[model samples]
Target: MRPQRRKTMGSMKKASVLLLLFLSLLLIASEEMVAVEGRTCESASSRFKGTCVRSSNCASVCQGEGFPDGRCEGLRRRCMCRKPC
Candidate 1:
């Protein structure tokens, strides 16, 4: 009986640890999504170049325009010029 109880407790502990790990992963994923949505750039020049901007002329085009925001950030991440928000 004692051995059986010990086994059950060990199994329960493993399950609890797995559950915590899963929850942590989920939280990290959600945080990444939020960062993606919140990130923004004013112009192509302000962009992170290869990291965000693709067009060589993007900076020239966006220079005079207002800074990009919200969905624009996502577009820039894809290496595309987006309208300012």
Candidate 2:
């Protein structure tokens, strides 16, 4: 937006520069989001018998399976183990 540069450049050049700057900003934002993301997954425990009713119970069994914590989910509410990737 310098006065001398503004007088020399046409409207199309200004619009192109603005569009390039906006795209660069979007690229930066997307990279930041991807870097902050974490991994999470669930798996049924073979040792955990029957239907899972409580998170506490699922957590205990998940710990036994070497996972840090777990929860009960799905329509049947099976024990789903979780761990960091």
Candidate 3:
């Protein structure tokens, strides 16, 4: 029983160490994924319903309008669709 307990403890320790190492590597890799700089073109959503209240909502409608990205902007709060050049 003592030998079996020691083996289980050792296995748990190894698993813990491996998991920590994996998480550390994942954190480092995720940090390397920041957005790249580029030129973007914008246009108002011609088919959007009502006013653009949220940028995310505007983006969703813009995607259906066949653009890559979108945002609510300016004094009128229009949905400005965006695409990279």
Please report the TM-score between candidate 1 and the true structure.
0.38
Error at 59, model 1, angstroms: 27
TM-score per prediction, in order, is: 0.38, 0.55, 0.56
What global local distance difference test value does model 1 have?
0.53
Estimate the lDDT of model 3. Answer: 0.90
Of candidate 1, the 10-residue stretch with the lowest lDDT total is 64-73
Q: What's the true lDDT of residue 5 in model 2? A: 62
Top lDDT prediction, candidate number: 3
The lowest-lDDT stretch of 10 consecutive residues in candidate 3 is 28-37
Model 1 lDDT per residue over 32-51, tens place: 44334543333333443455
For candidate 2, which ten residues in a row score worst on lDDT?
29-38
Candidate 3 deviant stretches above 4 angstroms: 1-36
Q: lDDT per residue, candidate 3, 1-80, as tens digits?
A: 37898899999999999999999999988886667889999988987878889999999999999998899999888999
Instruction: Tell how far residue 53 is off in model 1, in angstroms.
Output: 38
Clashes of 1: 1
Q: What are the C-alpha RMSDs, in order, of all predicted structures?
A: 10.3, 7.2, 6.2
